[model samples]
Every structure is written in structure tokens, then in C-alpha cells.
Target: MAHITAGVATSHVPAIGAALDNGKAGEPYWQPVFAGYEASKRWIAEEKPDVVILVYNDHASAFSLELIPTFAIGCADEFQPADEGWGPRPVPVVKGHPALAWHLAEKLIQDDFDMTIVNRMDVDHGLTVPLSLLFGQPAEWPCQVIPLAVNVVQYPPPSGNRCYNLGKAIRRAVESFPEDLKVVVFGTGGMSHQLQGPRAGLINREFDNAFLDRLIDDPAGQAAVPHLDYVREAGSEGIELVMWLIMRGALDEKVTVAHRFYHVPASNTAVGHLVLENALG
Candidate 1:
């Protein structure tokens, strides 16, 4: 049967992609951020998961105001990189795990999570930056991906509890799949920073750090935190942190946190990355 080997959590700042694509990764401001993921990149190369279930939000790139599904799973065979105003980052197109994706989608629906099954969609930086951070600029991604897009853009995004429960359901679905495949779940976005109005450049390092600590040691308790706390304390956009719970929920109750990196001021967002291995996987 398939098994979930690990989970990764990170911020998906677009500037991080620009830094890598424009050859500014080694600059002092960006060096530390990239350094944070050096260990992860190496570890991922070694672990070589067969498939990655990436949890991220689409930033008005693929789904505009016209339609926004709270939870959507990509069941397509391939996905193109999206051009988010500036231009599409020079990243390889993402190949999907159709068999596994369809299996999970079917199970999730039966499990009572009304997920939108997307046959095709262009993935934005939220999905690709995490891959680049872990795999570098590969000619083709080493493993196939299953994009799980959550709606964090609109107000009243899934609550922390709901996201956590969804992750648990996903873990159940994966374990039941007949293939003996290895899978990794990634929860991407947020440390703390707002990107609108007068508070556009807000950064709450204290809150961000505390969040990391809780996420690492007390995820179940953290899952009970209300949405207002994330917006009011962490910053409006910091609500993205809720997505991290999904990744946390998919893991073994006791996980070894292999690596963690946190840095601030990445173009109005704090960058956080973590790699977790399931103890009993």
C-alpha cells in the first residue's frame, strides 16, 4: 500500500522565485533564504519521493473572482506554469499523478469533503516556488505532483480545524491506495506579513516564530486557533498559515523535524520552511 513518508511547510513568496530566476539568489539579502533550504534540497534529492501532494493557494492567477473552490485537487496529467502579471517563472511544467490523484479525489468526496476536481489549470508561484526550493532548477521535476489548491484568497477561507481534518482524510486516502508508492505532503505559505492598504509591509517576527514553535510541538492545539487571530495578530495575509495545518495533520503523531528555516522581509512576507519525517511511515 502507498505511504506518506514526509511533509514540508514553506512560504511561497513570488520574489523568492524572481530572486532565483534573475540570478540574485546569492546576494546577501537572498543568500540566507536560499541557505535555509540547502539541507532540504539535498534531503529531497536523497529521499526521492515518487509523488508529492503540494498544498498551496492560487493567488488570483488561475482562478479569479469568477470561481473559487474552497478545496480543489488537480486530476490532470500535466499543468502549465501561470503568468502572474510579471511573467511566468522559468520552471518546468508540473506533471500530475493522475491515478493517485483520482483515487484520492474519489475517496475525499466519499469521506464528505466537497472537493472540486480540476482536470486542468495553470499553477501559480504558490505551487512552484516550494518545488524549486526543494529540487533546484531541474530539467524536469524528479517526481510527479498532485496539486491541492485551497482557497485562502477569499475571506472566510477554511478554518484551522477544517484544514486539519482534511489533511487527516487525505492521509487515510493515501494509505488505502493499492500501489506501494512513496508520497510527500507540502503545506505552503505564511510566516506573517500583510500586502494591502497602509499595513502592506507589516512583519510580525514574534508572532511568526511562536507560530513555528506551536506548529512543531503543538499542532492539535494550534489547529483550534480561530481565523481572526491569524488575521489580527499575524496579519491579514498571514491567514495562509492555516494551510500548514493540513500538512501537519497528514503526518504521524510523532514526527522528526529534520530541518527548519525562518527569515523575514521577503518582499512583505516572512519566509519559513520546514521538513518533517514520519516516525512510523
Candidate 2:
């Protein structure tokens, strides 16, 4: 049966993608950020998961006020990158694993989690940037991707606890699948930094680091964190961290920290990344 081998948590800052695409990654300003992921790129290449369940928020590119599903799973064969006002990033199209995706949707819904099943949707930086950060500039992504979009752009986004529980359900679903496959669950977005309002450029390194520490050592405690705390301390967009709980919930109780990286001011946002494997793996 298929089993989850690891979980990754990252910040999907769009400017990081632009820097890579514009050939500025080697420039002094961006070198540190890119350097942090060097070990990650090497590690993922070695692990080589067959499928990745990428959890990210759609940044109004695929869905807006007109429609938002609290939790949506992409069951399509492929996903095109969105324009995001700059035309699609010059990246390869995203090939998806429809079979595994549909299985997750069915199992999650049956487990009492309401999920919107998407047959087609253009993926934006929220999804692609993480891919680039880990996989680099490959002509094509190394493995099949399954987009699991969570709605953090809107108010009343799912709680950390709910997302965490959803991750547990996903693990159960994956193990029951008949295929022998290695899967990695990616939780993307957040590490303090708001894009607008008085606190638009907010960056709380203390809070961000603390959150990461808790995420690795005490996930259930982190999952119980309330929304107001994230808004007040980490900034509004900081709520994106809740999505990380989902990735944590999918892993074993104890995990080996394969790699961890964090940096500040990537387009006025905090960039954080972690690679964790099942303790036994």
C-alpha cells in the first residue's frame, strides 16, 4: 500500500519566484535565500517521492470573492500556471495525479471533511513557488503533483485543528491505496508578513521562529493556536501558517528533521522551509 514518507512546510513568497525567473538568484540580495534551499534541493532529489500532495492557498488567481471552497482538491490531469498580472511564470506546466487526488477527495469527504473537487484550475505562485524552491529550474517537475488548495485569503478560514485533522485523514487515505508509492505532503505559505494595511511590512522573527519550533516539537499544541493570535502577532496573512498543521498531522508522531531553513525580507515576507521524514524512514 502507498504510504506517506515525509512532510514539507514552506513559505511561498512570489518575489522568490520572480528572482529565480529573472536571473537574480545569484545577486547579493537574493543569494542567502536561495542558498538556504540548496540542501533541500539535494535532499528531495534523493528521496524522490512519486507523488506530492501540495497544500497552498489560491491567491485570488483561481478563486475570488465570487467563490471560495474552504478545502478544495484538484483531481485533474494537469494544472496550468496562472498569469498573476505578469503572465505565467516561465515554468513547466504542473502534471497532476488524478487517481490519488480523487481518492483523497473521496476519503476526506467520507471522513466528514467537506471538500470541493476541482477538475480544472490554473495554479498560481502559492502553488508553483514552492515547487520552484525545492525542484529548482527543471524543464519539468520531477514527480506528479496533487494540488490541495486551502482558503486562507477569506475570513473564517479553517482552523489549525481542522486542517491538522484533515491531514490525519489524508494519511489514512494514502495508506489504504493499493499502489506501492512514496508520497510527500507539502504545506506551503506563511511565516509572518502582511501585504497590506498599517502592518503591511510586519515581520515578527520571534513569533515566526517560535511557531516553527512548536511545529516540529509540539504540533498538537501549535494546532490549538487561535486565529486572533496569528493576526495580532504574525499579521493577517500570517494565518497561512495554519495550513502547515495539515502537513504536520500527516506525518508520524516522531519525525527526523532532514533540513530546515528560514530567512527574512523575501519581498517583505518571511520565508521558511522544513523537510521532515517519518522517524523510521
Candidate 3:
């Protein structure tokens, strides 16, 4: 049976993607952010998961006020990058694992989690940036990707507890699959930085670090964190961190911290990444 081997969580900052695409990653300001992921790139290359369930929010590129699915699973054969006013980043198209994706959608929905099944949708930086950060400039992504687009952009986004429980359900679903495959869950977005309003450039390092500590050591505690706390303490955008709980929930309750990286002021946003492997006997 298929099983989840690990979980990865990272911030999907758009500027980071732009820096890589525009050949600015080597600049002094961007070097540290890119450097932090060097070990991650190497580590993922070695683990080589067969399928990745990438959890990210659609930044109004694929869905706007007109429509928003709280949780949408892409079951298509491929996903094209969206033109976020910059004409789609010069990145390879995203190939999807329809079989596994459909399985997840079916099982998750049956598990009482309402999920929107998407046959087609253009993926935005929220999805691609994380891919670039970990996989680098590969002509094609190394493995099949299953886009699990969460709705963190709208009001009343799913609670952290809900996301975490969904992750648990995903693990159960994967374990039930007949194929002998390795799977990884990626939770992308957030490290406490608001894009607008009074706290336009907020970066609560203290809160961010504390959250990470709880995430690694006490995920259930982190999951219980109320939505208002994320908004008031981490900033509105910081709510994206809830997505990370889903990735955490997919893994063993006890996991080995394979790699952890955190940095500040990457495009006025905090960039955080974590690689967690299920503890082996």
C-alpha cells in the first residue's frame, strides 16, 4: 500500500519566484533565501517521492470572489501556470497524478470533508514558487504533483484543526491505495507578513518562531490555535500558516526534523521551510 514518507512546509512568496526567473537570486538580498533551500533541494532529490500532494492557496489567479472552493483537489493530467500579470513564470508545466488525486478527492469527500474536484485550472505562484524553491530550475519537475488548493484568500477559511484533521484523513487514504508508492505532503504559504493596511510590512519573528516551535513539538496545540490569533498576531496573510497544519497532520505524530529553515524580509514576507520525515523503526 502507498504510504506518506514525509511532509514539507514552506512559504510561497511570489517575489522569490521572480528573483529566480529574472536571474536575481544571486544578488545579496536574495542569496540567503535561496541558500537556505540548498540542503532541501539535495534532500528531496535523495528522497524522491513518487507523488506530492501540494497544498497551496489560489491567489485570485484561478479563483476570485466569483467562486472559491474551500478545498479543491486537481485531478487533471496537467496544470498550466497562471499569468499573474507577468505572463506565467518561465517554468515547466505541472504534471498531475490524476489517479492518486482522484483517490484523495473521493476519499476526502467521503470522510465528510467537502472538496471541490477540479478537472482543470491554472496554477499560480502559490503552487509553482514552492516547486521552484525545492526542485530548482528543472526542465521538468522531478515527480508527479497533486495540487491541493486551499482557500486561505477568503474569509472563513478552514480552521487549523480542520486542516490538520484533513491531513490525517489523507494519510489514511494514501495507506489504503493499492499501489506501492511513496508520497509527500507539502504545506505552502505564510510566516507572518501582511501585504496591505496598517501592518503592510509586518514580520512578527517572535510569533513566527513560537509558532514553528509549537508546530514541530506540539502540533495538536498549534492546531487548536484560533483563527483570530493568526490574524491579530501573525497578520492577516499569516493565516496561511494554517495550511501547514494540514501537512503536519499527514505525517506520523512523531517525526524527525530532517531540515528546517527560516528567514525574514523576503519581499517583505517571512519565508519559512521545514522537512519532516516519519520516524522509522
Candidate 4:
């Protein structure tokens, strides 16, 4: 089985990317955002994993209310850039791990999880922001990427438990693969901040901090938290916590915290980052 080298969680604040590339929004607050990812880049260079399974929620760019998939895996050879209001970030096209992705798709469906498999998909800032920050657009990406999109935009998205189950299935899929590879799973989006309506600007330090503590120590307890409570308390879009369950499930009961950082109110989003390393075999 391929070793899971690392896990990363980050908020995909668009302005952060813009600030780095064009000095467009390089506010005093945004400096920390870029500095926070410096270690991630260094770690990736040191570890140099072969595949990255990006767990991120789309912001109504590719998948929408017309067809809301609980969890969708990308099997495309290349993913295009989306026009995320500002524009594409001129990054290298995203590559897919077709052999592993397809095999995982088959096994997931057989295991009673219906995951949408897309041949064509365009990723938005939610996924790209972290990519650009962690691994800038070289002639090519540092590694092949398996884009995993979770639904956090539309109402009544997948439940927390369901996401946890999906993560378990993903672990099985990775373990079942025939070839040797190094895999890193990333769960992106939210420490807490709402972007729509009056409920926007809501920040829950208590809930967010409690979540970080529970995520490493008591995953099931964290996974069992009501998704609605996340919406009502953490902010509507803050329900993106479900994606983290996927990353958490891939990990063993015990993991060493490599690093962690947190900040608030970055363009109506709470920005945070964490790296988890599973117990050594």
C-alpha cells in the first residue's frame, strides 16, 4: 500500500491569491496568508508525493443546484480554469490520476457510495488558491492531482456522517491500488465565515477551536456534530467542515500535528491551515 505522507487543510480565500500574483489585494492582513503557506511549499518539496487528492467544495462554478453531487471525483486528463469573477490564475492545468481515480470510483460504487465521476470539470478558487500558494505554477505541477469536489454551496448537502463514510471508502480505495505511490490528501475550506445575507460576518471562535481540538483527538465526536448546527452557528457556507471528515477518516486514530495556523475575516472567510501525519508503521 502507498503511504499517506501528509494532510493539509486551508481556506481558499480568492483575494489572497490575487494579492500574491498581481499585488492587487495585498492588504496588511493578507501578508500572513502568504507567509502561512511557506512551510507547506517546503514540506512538499521535501516529501515530493506522487499524487495529491484535493478535497475541496466548489463555489457553484462547475457543479450546481441542477445536479448536486455529494462527492464527485475527477478522472479527466486535464481540468480547465474557471472564470471565478476575477479570472483564471494563469496556473498550469490540473492533471488527474486516471488509473487510481477510476479504480477508486469502481470500488466506491461497489461499496455502496455513489460518487459522481466527471470526465470534464473546471475548478474554482476554492481549490486553486491553495494550489497556487503551496505550489506555484511552474512549467508543470509538482505532482499529479486528483480533484475531489464536495457540495457545500447548495442547501441540504451531504451529511457529516456520510462524508466520514466516504473517507473510509477512499482509504480502502487507496489501499487496494496495485501500484506503489505516495498520496497526500487535502481538505480545504473554512475555519468559519459566512458570505451571504445578514448572517454573513459571523465568527465562532469557540466552535472553530473546539473543532480543531476534536478533529485530532475525537474524530467521531466531531463527525457526529449536526451539519445544521454548523450552518446556524458557524455560518451557512461554514458547513464545509464535512470535507475535513474525509481527510480525518483517512488518518488513523492517532496523528502527530506537524503544524497549525489560524486567522479571521479574510474576505468574509476564516483562514486556517493544518498538517497531520499519521502514526508510523
Q: Report clashes for each candidate as comma-separated counts.
A: 0, 0, 0, 0
Alpha-carbon lDDT of model 1: 0.93
What is the lDDT, from 0 to 100, of the residue 163 in candidate 3?
Answer: 95
Clashing pairs in 1: none
lDDT comparing candidate 4 with the true structure: 0.81
Per-residue CA lDDT of candidate 3, range 1-281, in tens? 99999999999999999999999999999999999999999999999999999999999988899998999999999999999997999999999999998989889999999999999899999999999999999999999999998999889899999999999999999998999889999999999989899989999999998988888999999999999999999999999999999999999888899999999879999989999999851
- Name the runs in model 4 displaced over 4 angstroms: 24-27
What lDDT does candidate 4 reach at residue 217?
Answer: 89
Candidate 2 lDDT, tens digit per residue, 93-164?
999999999999899999999999999999999999999999999999999999999998889999999999
The model with the greater TM-score, 3 or 4, is: 3
Candidate 4 lowest-lDDT run of ten: 18-27
lDDT of 4 by residue, 1-281 (tens): 76576677777877776776676544677776667777877877887889989999888789777889878999988888788777777777888889988988999999998889999999988788878877865777888888899888877778887887777788888988988999888888887878779877888888887888888888888888898789877898778887888888877778888877777767777777878887772
lDDT of 1 by residue, 39-105 (tens): 9998998999999999999999779789999999999999999998888889999999999999999
- Predicted structure with the largest lDDT when compared to the true one: 2
Instruction: For model 3, give the 10-residue run with minimal summed lDDT.
Output: 272-281
lDDT ranking from best to worst? 2, 3, 1, 4
**Candidate 2 ranges beyond 4 A from true positions:** none
Model 1 TM-score, 2 decimals: 0.98
Cα-based TM-score, every candidate = 0.98, 0.99, 0.99, 0.95
